[model samples]
Target: MTSPPQPAAGPVSPLNSPLEPESNRKLAMLLLAIVLYIGVLLLPTPAGLTPAGQVALGLLVLVVTLWISECVSPANSAVILTGAAVLGLMGKSLTPGARPMKSADALAAMLGGFSSTAVLLVAAALFLAVALKHTGLDRRVALLVMSRVGISPARLTLGAMIVGLVLALFIPSATARVGAVIPIMIGITAALGLPINSSLGATLMIVTAQACSIFNMGFKTGAAQNLISLDFMQKAFGRTVTWSEWFLTALPFTASMSVVLFLASLFLLRPQVPPAAEAEAKLRAQLAELGPLSGAEKRLIAVAVLLLVMWSTEGVLHPFDTTTTTQIGIALLLMPRIGVMHWSQAEKLVPWGTVVLFAASISLGTLLSKTGAAGWLAQQTLGQIGLSALPVVMVVGALSLFSIVLHLGFASATGLASTLIPIFIAFAQTLPVTKETAFGIVMIQSFVVSFGFILPTNAPQNMLCYATGAIRTKEFAKIGLVVTVAGLLLIMLLSATVWPMMGVL
Candidate 1:
């Protein structure tokens, strides 16, 4: 759903350079990963770090290096990690001394990630995204929201963000939401005869992308990474965080950031010239051409609303969890009477690779936690730096800063979560705090996993929006860095006050 290339709003020469060939780069990165893995393996196992833990740490380094360098696709790289774990972690014991893990047992433990309901939930989300696209419901919703706004720059920018917030609920995949909603944004810029290269045009696209990231934390199903974080949190803390509960916790941060994002576009990245007075008319006209909702749209709406009710009422009106309810919702859509879309239709749009990658990532994180590698590594790093000795707010601040800087090297937040979340979960555990406070630390940091706010390459949706040629990497960074800092301060606020009040911090 990417718009065709539009006129670039800013200079690009600053970001371009000659680079090595792709195959050569892959070979170089793979070699670097192998070196790091062997380096870890050769390191004398520190006290309390068993042989198995050391091997797990080695595998973590190898896979992360590969992922960061794009040496291999994340799914295949995960497959490598799994195969390695099956062989590498079949040890005599998990602790200093214990019962031996049989080869079959090692294989089973390594594959637990694929068996997790989170994988199925992600697959279910893809199916739902496909069904929405098949019915064109997502695009209609976006346009309907856009149709309601006046043509002022402030109104148009706010309209784009509202579209993102609303679509984030209905369209679970961030890229899919951008695909459905942003072409309309581009069309509006085009219709206004505004070169996307202009300040107004570029900011419009950037905010559309940023808004997707903002609300990715707002809803449990907003992004795949959110589920990744949730999976880690539940495993570490052994408690469920229901859909409504997550919404209530995230509302203050997401809502405040939404307002900040709007203001930034208006004052910080002001358009060179105001859009034509006819912009709203064109938006409504495009929405009008879609005409009345189709039969499929109506049925899809009903199913969506029913699912929303079920999701909101979980633990209150019913015992069904999010994964179960989502599966039920998709099943209804595929059924004969409901008939939102055929399995064949969804099959075409559904991203099976994402499901594979997500499952594999979980396996990687699971290996880290189960083998005690994460805890030992946390002891080595966070403990070494005395982060645990800092004040509670300072601990959060330092962690947030670390997460932001680390995010510069990561392209996929899901990959970042799979790598760092387990360690942080262990970091929380090792903190000299109550079991509840430790759990709270993990919960609060999970929100930081959505911090793909500093680079165009940081997220799939950012890359998708960047393809429009409306925003240069440098220009995007200007807005992204500001949002990243603002988001960090907001998290600090929540951690200091609201999250603690809610027993989350």
Candidate 2:
């Protein structure tokens, strides 16, 4: 009656992984970056741009190549790109007819992102994720609700979507949210006696991962990249996007996509879940075992609701920006006796590399703008496309489709935003619209940066769920294509309608 031994797992496909940056590939990418850097420097500096701008453009290409290929660690690449900027271009002034740049002055612009509000918000958001993980409140919330959805295949799929939507508000880190939700989903799949790769299992996991991504567009704090985009916008235009405004700006689109994600998950993936009659009790029991929310859960929930309020009312009920409010909340969570967790425990759980990457992304994009490289590059590329001649709606569609295609090359949306948002900010400026509307155009494109649908490696959340071994790359890509198409169209539609009405188009 004993079962035979399971087969040894083979090598993981790169399509389903974050594609670790190591070996010959890493060296090759670095060499390519060098070739690109040298080539750009050798070319005649384009008209309307400074010699410093050309150097910055070369750095942009080289750094982007490293980031997308992930040939070097993000933090390392960030530092490398900035150092190269200061070292190579300190004598060249970015502004025509200005004093030649000094080392400290050039260095200051390169590191500007590290001091911005968006970077601090990103750090605080990670702390929020850590607190949830420390208290297991994230798991409890996910399981408690999902356990209630009947074991029907479609219902289970919808439950996953609902969990992702709810968690988007509570957990700012999409990767952390998926990490907490996917295993619970896999467990539910297992208790039903289904194989991990069952249509139902794969469908559930796919939707679980995509849901986390889809909702990242909804909240300003939902994704680290959103903060990065806001930082770029702030630096470029001196505008601030509040939590509630971001929510309202995004709600119609995110809401529509959420439904599209569900239909696509249910019908496209076609999860043929069987009636696992008994597993329902196992699901409920899992939630029950937590034994009536402990003291930590109580404190975490109370603080979370309050933080949610604080985040939502910024610029309306309070002048405290998202970063200030978030730091205040994190402070409460780290207090000795009254808090849910300690700095020692919370720090251990936080991904400090994210902070590095966030700061670096901001710095890279800021430097690109400061040196006029982003605008120059945009003029050479997007500018040639005659986007200004097209209606504002077409601008949305064009930039969105471009972002999706560019995302194929990127592993992190933060990197994508760094590489493109500045270019986008510049590109938007050329569009025949008011300055405010042009800023809105850049904000809209940032949402597309979150579209990590086509491949697992494209987003951290997608990769985390893919690691469960329940879904194949092709299956994930199948759904991603549908969502990508749908998301792009929705963005365009909103650009013409909702966004315009809000004066955001």
Against the true structure, whose lDDT is highest? 2
Q: Tell me the spans in candidate 1 whose CA falls farther than 4 Å from its real position.
A: 1-20, 90-103, 272-277
Q: For candidate 1, lDDT tens digit of each residue in 1-505?
A: 9989998777545335244466678988888888888898889988978888888888888887877888888677877777777777675465556777778877777778889998998899888888888888888888888778767688779889988888788667888989887788888888787887777789889998999988988998888887887898888888868889888988888899888888777888887545565777787788888889998899989988988898888899999999999999999899986768888878888887788888888887887787798988888888899888887878888888888888888888888888888999899887888888887676667778788887998888999989989999988898888889898898888889988898777
TM-score of 1: 0.92
Task: Quote the lDDT for 383 in model 2.
Answer: 94
For candidate 2, give the lDDT.
0.86
The number of residue pairs in model 2 that clash at the backbone is: 0
Measured with C-alpha atoms, the lDDT of residue 263 in candidate 2 is 90
Cα-based RMSD of the predictions, in order?
A: 7.0, 5.6
Clash pairs, model 2 backbone: none
Runs with alpha carbons beyond 4 Å of true place in candidate 2:
1-22
Q: How many clashes (backbone N, Cα, C below 3 Å) per candidate?
A: 2, 0
Q: What global local distance difference test value does model 1 have?
A: 0.83
lDDT of model 2 at position 307: 91
Q: Write the per-residue lDDT of candidate 2 for residues 180-238, one digit (tens) a residue.
A: 89888988888888898999889988998888888999999899889889888887788
